[model samples]
Target: MTAGQVSNNGPKPLQRNLSRRVSFNEATLARSQEPPKPPAEPEFIDTEAQVVSRPPYSACCNSCCAWTSLVLAVLLLLSILVGGVYFAFLQSNLPQVRLHRLDVYYLEVNNTDTDTFLTSDLEVRLNFTNDNSKIKLSYSRMTASLTAEGVDLGTVTVPAITQEPSSSADVRARTWMRKTSAEEAVAEDLRDNSLKHLMVIDVVLKGHIDFLVNGNKMNGFPIKVSCRSIDQSEIDNGHAPKCGVQMTPL
Candidate 1:
């Protein structure tokens, strides 16, 4: 009941409430040190965007196809044109050959009952004509043979010659046989009169020719002339028989 006793009156109700509030504030400050939370999600947009591009086809492909078609058409047209030209002009005007004359210098036979021999010298003349008006003709490496009724008497070789367009030329070859088996057989036929005095002879000519067409020269085509069953009497009368000619390709 004195001053000391009043002073000792332990904590009123207000102090007690103030002490509880101070303790709660210290606890809230301790929890504030944790990591911060992430931000909230934003709203979504609803619009879409589109871009325009060029077409896939181009002019180069079309141009290449056009050129290819044009080239093929031109080649086909040229082939048809060349074929027509050859058939109309070049195929019909082939060269011709003739057998002009054959001259025998001497023919002698030596016969003993056991052995027979013969000797002769001869000359042959030929006429060649080129009927082509646009092409020039030439013959090379010429060779010839003389035969009588399947028996080959002799062979001759001649030099090369050139003939102008639409012109004729003459050539000659000389053959001589001395003491040969072929000559002996020919002599036996003459003695036996097996030819019936017709004196039939054959002339064969073989060679290659060159033809110049449109300023271009092409060679190595074969030329063959064959004259058969020619009479000696015709030669003496200054006349000749026609011969056949062929162009054989090699």
Candidate 2:
């Protein structure tokens, strides 16, 4: 074919459309074949900074130290005050208090009611001599324990006893020791009524106490309270003293 005949058979519209499609395809191909670009570098901050370290505060520590100092000062003051008081007490109350002699004069016990042990009464008489040269015992405290038939009954507190300087003083006290059933105490051991048969009494005269220098406690001479008898000659000779009263059935 001739050149003019081939050009006449070619499609003009289709060729224009094919050329646009090839242009888009070539742009896409070139974009897919290109290498990726690196990311932009991060921005650098160029700011001047000031370093600051907070200083320690001692408000709570100072408060605690002040409180501890106050407590220690208060404790030291209290100790000094107590020591001064103890020293003053020692200086004022302590004195040479001597015990002379405590002698029992009389003892009485009556047990008329065997069933009721509380209706009984007792009277004890005592004498004390003051042998101290510096101090005089004006008042005394005496305690006595009573027992019946080898059984402890009760205790009795005597009143104050007074003795002059190098002189003897008499003391007497009478009271009931309340319900003291000596028979009930020993009922488990002995079946028979040992308490009803006869009256048995044991009296103990503890050491006499004297209030020296007003209220200070001091020792006094020892004495005994008993219902046992003694000879009249011995009593007159100041040896064995006789007791006037004895025990009665309860």
lDDT of each: 0.76, 0.49
Clashing pairs in 1: none
Residue 187 displacement in candidate 1 (angstroms): 1.5
* lDDT accuracy of residue 161 in candidate 2: 59
lDDT of 2 by residue, 161-225 (tens): 55545676655544455454444435333223222223334455443334454455455433344
TM-score on alpha carbons, each prediction: 0.60, 0.32
CA shift of 72, model 2, Å: 30
Model 2 misplaced regions, further than 4 Å: 1-118, 138-141, 177-180, 184-201, 205-250
lDDT string for model 1 (48-102, tens) is: 4222243445699789889999999999999999977864554455577777777
Q: Evaluate model 2: give its lDDT.
A: 0.49
In lDDT terms, which candidate is top?
1
